[model samples]
Target: SLILTESRSYWLASLTFLLLFSLMSFRSNKRLILTSAFILLTAGAVISQVPVLKDRFHSITDTKNNGSNITRLMIWKSHIKAFTEDYTLTERIFGAGDNASKLAWRHFGRAFQEVTGKEEIPPPGELRKWFHGGETHNLYLKFLTKYGILGLLGYLFFWIYVIYRNLERRDSLFIKAFVAGYVGFLVASFFENNFTDAEVQFTLFFILGVNFALISETAVRQR
Candidate 1:
């Protein structure tokens, strides 16, 4: 499970390598099989230890965040109310921009404090200072508010293109495996704002791009 937590991509990549090695080993390519397995294993081990790297790996898996998780859901519910109050086609498509976060903070913070009976303040030290405005914790909503409907459409389109181009090739098992893992990550992003988190976004895009490249190579070989 820990290994699974480390990286969905790595796990998928390792599986692909193992499958390929198993299939090709019968051809007496002992050295090639050993080299590929060793390299993949080393990479997976090293990546699991790096702080940011590990976060990306874990992002693909669902983590229980205790009770604190509901705050965002509550905030989202409140946001829906605010959006309904306005209910303009313009607001729905273009959004109210940074103002939405402020509105959410005021409503959600007050509610949170009232319910929990705790005064909310920024945390101690640099982290608090850096984040002058508290986070919404929902990347899709954040982008929607900031960039509007057109931006959301463009963003989704880009990912769709990436997935389509990468997974279209049938020749490479590695590409196929990576795409499978990526699809999992994409699904998780709906519930969690995975793209807003730097670590998650980086790992997701990197693997997607890598898979695309692998697929391209395989297509070339088949031609």
Candidate 2:
């Protein structure tokens, strides 16, 4: 019995082609490659924005019953206040560990009450709670709260190394594509904790590790 089965093969294939095209664009003046990549990205973005597509996507992931947009907006507003209150040198450097949620809740609770003027209203449930949901739903913020400044610096270093190596290669299409796709992930991580989930974490680390390994192999072959 196979423990794992690959799902969404079509989507994965599209992403693979997109990554390849993005990388090829870096080393060659190929308009077709760039155009193909742009079309793929635009198609994915447009599909994501459509209500029916969005609903279907959520349903596949079992997130169909998630909170409404208004609730999320309110939570984010409250979260901004909490983050500001807790934004300190110590918190920025050493992080708050697993206790970040409790601290955020206390801070946001006060802010929420003050803003809404509701005395007995209960705090939002698991879906509404930032930490309960496993993070603040932001990768940068999550790193700040969990790993602190030092960790963030280390993380940035890894990315810099990847980009530097890619730039040094004159005709490496794979390197270019990997870096471009990585940048895309970085952008998306700002609004969502894309790295916090186990599945995502594994995939990210696997891709990065493979890219590094490939680069190393190429260097060895050259030597």
- Which candidate leads in TM-score? 2
Candidate number with greatest lDDT: 2
Q: How far is candidate 2 from the true structure (C-alpha RMSD, Å)?
A: 6.6
Roughly what TM-score does model 1 have, to 2 decimal places? 0.55
lDDT of 1 by residue, 1-223 (tens): 5354644544554455455544444355556667767876776687677876666655544324323344545555546555556436787688777677555544554444544456874433532232235454555666666566776787788878876776576335565555555555554454456677789778867876777667777778789
Q: Each model's C-alpha lDDT?
A: 0.58, 0.61
Against the true structure, what is every candidate's RMSD?
8.1, 6.6
- Clashing pairs for model 1 are none
Model 1 is weakest, by summed lDDT over 10 consecutive residues, at: 123-132
lDDT of 2 by residue, 1-223 (tens): 0102222323444455566555557457577576876777776676677776555445434422433332333445555555567657776677767766656666555544554555655646732443344346567777766677787787778778877887776367677777667766666565567777999999988997898898888888889
